[model samples]
Target: MASKPPDILLQGIDALRRVSRHMFRYRASIIAFFAVLLLIYGLYLRPPSDFPAGKTLSIPRGATLAEAARLLEEGHVVRSAHAIKIATYLFGGGTNIDAGDYRFPSPINALRIAYAITVGNFGRSFIRVTVPEGATVREIGALFALGTFTAFDYDAFLAAAKAREGFLFPDTYLFASAVTSDEVITTMQKNFLQKIGQLEPLIQSSGHSLADIVIMASLLEKEARSNETRRTIAGILWRRLEIDMPLQVDAVFGYIRGADTYSPSLEDLKIKSPYNTYLYPGLPPGPIGNPGLAAIEAAATPIASPYLYYLTDTHGIMHYSLTYEEHLKNKRKYLP
Candidate 1:
């Protein structure tokens, strides 16, 4: 209006007005497109409607992210494998996912699943079970079976862990309610290796095979409750082995007959089993029970002592003697 604005300026204003009208006409369509994208993204984040509730999904060890995502999809745990992979890649900071059995009792989002696997946040309730030192494989199996949440298969555990008796480290473990026998065995054995790995130098320098040390420690574990007594007993046992003397440990009878008593009857000593240290002149064929770290260390580094005979009294007190006559006297004094 002021001097009839220049033609070029008028043309620019006309172009701007045309652009605004076009945007206003198509505003609803643009919003709908964005809403559709958001809906799709939200669906990708949710669990599949057919999710396998109360089912265990096993992720193999060392599985790649792609493989894990595929397994989650196949297990009906996620709506989209790609979404989980993206979520993990973004949030996990490129860490390896944990391998184990995962149970989803209810629906969970893909982001949650990603976080769980990345951080080993297994959603299942864990049952705390303590495997006592000196427990045999059978005893360990029974202990696990006693848990209300464990639904543990006693026979399967015994069968699988029979050969791994002493190698299965005894410790307090938190296991899933539906843990399998193989899983339990693997966990204990893995723990054993990890714990023993720390003492590798000591074990190597002791001039004794790991097997022998474990067997000796098993005996020490059953014979004495204190580290000092165990070390003393270990020295005595090693000296006896040098002279080819019978170990004559009564704990072997418990392994053979499944009896809890440490005092074997006169007849029980005569049993022909190779595990009978009284009948056999060397270390038992294998460890009678799992041993703790203190017992293991005592076996590896036995104290020098003159005592050859030792016994535990009814009150759990230990008596050490240099000769058989003194041992008998202590036995009479301490035994019931």
Candidate 2:
């Protein structure tokens, strides 16, 4: 009592009391506002929790972002479905997310994952298959039957490629596991067209139809191993055609039987088939196998030679003779 309280002190006390009262009156609202801010920050910008790597996530075709989020949650790829949806909605390039099997080999952020899906990054892994040169359509179908691609149907592939026998180019190819038969056929055919385009001018001026060149090339593929040998054989075969002589190649027997044979007997040659070049004059009805670019080129530009007969021996050496007697002598020496 004694000393009167300072006016300044009284004023300071009044201000502090008023401020405390205001805080108490809206305490719940203030708490809620901070909570909402924290949630928003976590949903939009927080790094996702680390998960064990090597997980595969599959999103079906035409899946919405919400559905994808649920799938991710089920796979344990992401922690919260709601958070994924919200984050994707805000940062995803677009609403459309590409649907396919995706393998997460390492830890990745949610934002990056969303971006990858939106941009059609299905985490592409290729099944590499090698189709050897001169492979037949049936052989190629068998390869597809044993391929890693789960959706590759051997019967469907056979049906699709039956009519495309010599036109299906043989080469190593990489395709997704879910690739369709039609897609495989189309790709091989397109590759054939593109590769043949390089020899268009030569084919045009060679005075032989494209089909004829292909037929000759296919024979060379089976007959010879090197480009020079192919060219020489091409000349001998072409010379035979000019004189109305039969090609008499053993490779046609393999084609007719749908099996490979090193030596065809006289009885095998007696079988009546249009592909039997031994009986028929000139080229066969069609190609026997898919020939590579080198063979095709050799057929288009054969090196002229005086020799009329040729054969490969046990040591892989080619013998050429101009006379039938000489040919028979070399054959007896090398073959027997």
Model 1 per-residue lDDT tens digits across residues 49-93: 898877788898989889999999888898888888998987753
Model 2 per-residue lDDT tens digits across residues 208-277: 9999999899899999999999999999999999999888899888889998555799898887898888
Task: List candidate 1 stretches off by more than 4 Å.
Answer: 1-50, 61-69, 78-100, 109-121, 147-152, 197-202
- Model 1: lDDT equals 0.88
Total clashes for model 1: 0
Worst 10 residues of 2 by lDDT: 44-53
TM-score of 1: 0.74
TM-score of each: 0.74, 0.71
lDDT of 2: 0.83
